[model samples]
Target: MIWVHLLIVLAAIFLGARYGSIAIGAAGGLGVILLGATGAPVSREDIPFDVIGIIMSVIAAIAAMQAAGGMDWLVALTDRLLRKKPKRITLLAPIVTYLLTLFAGTGHTAFAALPVITEVAKENDIRPSRPLSIAVVASQMAITASPISAAVVFMASVVEPLGVGYLTLLAIAIPSTFLATVATSFLANMLGKPLSSDPVYLERKEQGLIELRGAHEYEERPGAKRSVLIFLIAIIAVVTYAALISENLNIISDPTLPRTEAIMSIMLAAAMAITVLCRIDPSEILGMQTFRSGMSACVCVLGVAWLGTTFVSTHMEAITAFAGSALTAYPWLLAVVLFFAAALLYSQAATTKALMPTAIALGASPIAAIAAFPAVSALFVLPTYPTLLAAVEMDDTGSTRVGRAIFNHPFMIPGIVNIALAVGLGFLFGSLML
Candidate 1:
């Protein structure tokens, strides 16, 4: 069954939606059947409903932001900033991604920022892949550092029984993740020189894919500045509130108070207030297609979470038993093993939930596990991630392909090295056992 799960995830990575869905669905079906036959406590009632709610609310908020053209506006803003200097653009791209992911608690926010990062890279004659790589890597790094991210929240929950403080784990993770990002960017730039002169670059340049066009239509709308400001304020308020609640800072801790509910309430209120204040019609804000798209995202998230939960529950005893023995025999193998495991799974959240508890049971440090989070999370850099696919489609230059030409393209090699550097630094920072 474990092997079946692994194969399904790998097949998903290779064949994408059509095959990936079949593979995952089949594996999940088999797991359920086997569990039922064995009389395992694999009831669907055990599914993580809170996780489903979080996913749906997040999708809704992102959809709303997209409909409001905030994403497009952000791209234009990045273009304006990066048009001045390649060096500054190079430095700022990852920094901006890190900040966004820290606040938003979703890599999708960083992924949304990619088009802007790519645009800036184009404007400066820098490879769009360069900034895109940085954006993705930085986003993964932020998951470990962010107190509000799913990985952090999940880790906090799992490690609580191990006598680990969430803040203490976070303090260790932040420095390690930050160092890893810097090292990754530096190493990637060094190895990716040949990619700059690749034929795809020349072709993209000729096709004007690298050129900035007339002002984006969204930027010229009436009261755009005010709307943007309001949106930013709303985002800031949400982050501040999340932090306050997570830390229990001077606020009564309501054990029943759901974080997702709080987040959704804040986002909805902000979105409504900003729309009315800017005199934007609700219909216009939602657009014609936003609802369906948002619903699709919600469904996907829910299905994936349910599938992951089902898989975990069915295999819980076997996985825990194996992890206990394995860790006792080979402690240092945990980091590398988990890295490739997550790469195969293509989902840090799923991998963390499935494996982190087992690792904690085997006496892994919460701080060490937290530090290792980024390394496992970075595994999604494989061309399999939907956002990476979107970026590739948008470019259409084959520049983002994993290994069509040389292994050292801006997107390919840098992403690989980024993961390696992150893992290496995790060990160096005492985040992982060597």
Candidate 2:
């Protein structure tokens, strides 16, 4: 019966993978019905409404920021920083992209910087794949580090009972992911033949396909500066409030609200403030790219997380009995599981919400679980993700591309190295926090 339940879960994962993106969530709910038919009905307890609310609210604020041209303002600042040191873009590009996504709490922010990284690499005669690959990976890896990311929020809820605080998670995640990104840049720089000597690149050049497009002259929209500042202030407010109310601080004398509710309120307020103060049409936010991706993320988290919870909740006791001692002895194996789960799910937040609960329930320590958090960034294993596809598209040099094998894309090696190192660094840093 457990095996049958597991098979149902696998089939749902397969169907979600086939359906792609937000469809996974829909496929997940169907899987639940299948689970019920197989004599395992998911109760209301299996659903994760809190996680969904947090994702939607965060996305709303992000969408409002995009509609307000705050994202454009940040991109413009990134462009200036990159041009100041074209020679070091191999290292610098990932830093820029990493910080953008880290602060923005979503990898979509990397899109603004991908074009800039590719162009700089091209101007310096560096292979666009180097910076482009690591930059995209960096953007994603930063999500695990971001205090406001849905993945981190989910992780905090899972591990708080295990004695981990939000700030501790951030402290370990930030340095660990940053060091991994830096190491990935070195590996990325060595990938493929030199740009000038690469035959495919030369062929593309002969076809007059690769052009050294100059820097873009960005004209700021009205209130762009003010909007970005307001958004930043909102972020600072969120972080500060979280810090004060954290278990370590205990600054809240009388607390009636869960952190999830607080986060939702703060973000929704930020979105509304951006809409009103920026004087942008509230309707415009719904049309922004960030809004669409965010909504997709919300749906993805809803379905996949609910499905995952159902499967795990049904089988958790058997799993705990079977793998408990082994996992308790070798908790790092949990990170391996997280990496592959995220690879299949293609969503950090969904993957986190779905799997972390079972692991924590099974006795994975807060330290081990938090250390493994970086592995949730494994969306790069498949090239189908938006950032990976965007990196491929933005590169005009033909240097950045997917291989004959579906997973043989340029991001594969660097992304793999990045996740592996991040997990290792996470363990290292996590030891101190523990």
Candidate 3:
């Protein structure tokens, strides 16, 4: 029966991956129904309502910023930063991508910067693959670092009953992921040949496969800077409020509202402020690229989390027995297993919510789990992720590429390196902090 149920869940994931984002959620719902009919216990509380709220609120605020041209202004700034330091872009691009995901709470923000990094690197005779690969990895890694990110929010809640809190998780995630990105950037710099000397790029150049070059261009809307300033101010406020309320400081008194409420209200109110002050039409928020991508993420998280939670919760005994015995002997393998799972699930929130709870029940230490939190960013192990795909599309020089073999993409090394440093440092930091 357990094997049968597992097969159904896997089939749903396969269908979701095959059809694309929203299909995953639909398939998850179908799986839930199939499980219950087969006498597997299903609970309503298994749904990640808090994670959903966090994602919707953050994405709503991001969409509002996008509608107000804040994303454009930020992207335009990133373009200038890359062009001005083209020689150093291989190092700086990952930092830029990391910060973009850290603040924005979604790696999709890196889409705007991917082409610019590739182009700048190519023009400077640096291999575009170097920056493009690491930049994408940094972007995904930042999701674990972002305070309001669904993954972080979900992680905080999972470990909360064991005494971990929001800022504690952030403490472990931020510095670790940032350091990982830096290390990954250094190594990614050495990959492939200089753009002018590369066989692939040179052949493409000779074959006229290289697209015509132009300076990165984005027309700054009238209120772009103001909108960006307001959005950033809102982000600062969210982080500040989270810090005050989180376990790190415990400065804020118990309020009528939960931190999730604080986040939702702050983001919605900020969106309103941005809409009015930046002269953005509120309806336009729903039409922005960020808005659509965010909604799609919501569905993916919904389907995947629900399916994963249901399976783990229903089969807790079998899961606990197997995982507890194995993890007791080799605790660090938790991150290793999650890294591989994330490579398939391709979602930080979904993977964390689905598996972390079971790990906790299996006697996994909070500190160990916290230290290994960044391993969930391993989706870039495969080149199918959106940011990875976008990086490939943006590299007109043919330098950034998936090799002939399936797992031989340019992103593989950076993804592994970033996750490795993050997990290793997570253990180091988790010891000190937790």
Candidate 4:
């Protein structure tokens, strides 16, 4: 029965991979139905509504900011910083994207920075793949560290009762992932041939196909800075509140609103504030690309997490019986498992909600789980991911092209290095901190 049920989960992932976008969530919903029809126990309690709520609220605030031109403001700032040190774009690009994701709580923000990274690399005659590869990976990994990201939020919930809180999780996740990303930049710098000497680039240049059309000058909108300031203040408020009420602090005991609920309220309030203060139309927020992408992500989390949690709940006993001892003995294997599952799940929040609870039940310690949390950023394994494909497409020099062998792409090596080193550093940090 477990094997049969596992096939259904795999089939859902396959359908998601084939169809793309919201189909991933729809396929997951179908998997849930299949599980119930096949006599597997299904429970409504398995649905991760809290995780969904957190993601939706965060997305709303971010979308509101985007509608007000705040994202453009941020990109323009990063662009200026990158141009100052063109020769170090490989090291700087990922750092820029990483910080963007950290603030926005979504890797999709990397799209706004990708064009700039490519242009900087091209201007310096450096291979665009060097910066682009690590930039995409860094953006993905940053979700685990982002204070408001659904993945980190869900992780804090699971670990809080076990003596780890939100701030503690950030303490371990941020430094570990950030430093690993910086180290991987060196590896990314050496990934492919120099832009001038690469055969594909040379051919493209000979064919007059290599156009170095730089990004346009970005004019700040009337309310862009104000919107960004409002959103940043909201984020600070969320973090400050969470820290005060955390188990470690116990400063706000028995509060009527729990941490998750507080986050939703604060973000929704921030969205309203942005709409009113920025004088932006509410409908325009709905039309923003970030809103559409984010809402779609909410659906994906809903369906995939529901499907995964249902299956895991029904087979909890069997799963624990089969893999519990091994995991208990080699806790690091938990990170390895999460790394591959994330590749299939295609969502850090969904993967965390689905697996972390079960890991805790099987005797995995809080530190072990926290150390492994960064592994869920392995969304680059397949080339079909939006940001990964965007990196490949935005590079006109042909230096960032994907190979016929799907795994042979430029992002693979750098992404793998980042995740591996992050997991290692996570353990080191977790041991020292917690």
Candidate that would win on lDDT: 4
Candidate 3's C-alpha runs over 4 A off are none
How accurate locally is residue 187 in candidate 3, as Cα lDDT from 0 to 100?
Answer: 90
Question: All models: lDDT?
Answer: 0.57, 0.84, 0.83, 0.91
Error of 3 at 377 (Å): 0.7
lDDT of 3 by residue, 51-114 (tens): 8888888888888888877887787788888888888887999999899899888888988888
Higher-lDDT candidate of 2 and 4: 4
Clashes of 3: 0
* Model 1: per-residue Cα lDDT over 1-434, one tens digit each: 56675444344434433344234334444544554454455566645455445444544454455555655666566656655565666567777777776755566666556666665555555655666666676776677676555566666677655655455556566777766666666654544434358786777768866546433344555545555566567567655655555543525365355555665666566567656665666676555243444444344433444455555666767777777676656555566666765654455555566567667766666545654566667444355555565566655444555665433334555555665666566556654422
Residue 414 Cα positional deviation in candidate 1, in Å, after optimal superposition = 3.1
- The TM-score-based order of candidates, best leading, equals 4, 2, 3, 1
Question: What tens digits encode model 2's per-residue C-alpha lDDT throughout 171-211?
Answer: 99999999999988988888888999989899999999988
Better of 3 and 4 by TM-score: 4
Which run of 10 residues does model 1 get worst, by summed lDDT?
Answer: 16-25
What C-alpha RMSD separates each model from the true structure? 4.6, 1.6, 1.7, 1.0
TM-score, one value per model: 0.77, 0.96, 0.95, 0.98
Error of 4 at 30 (Å): 1.3
Q: For candidate 4, report its TM-score.
A: 0.98
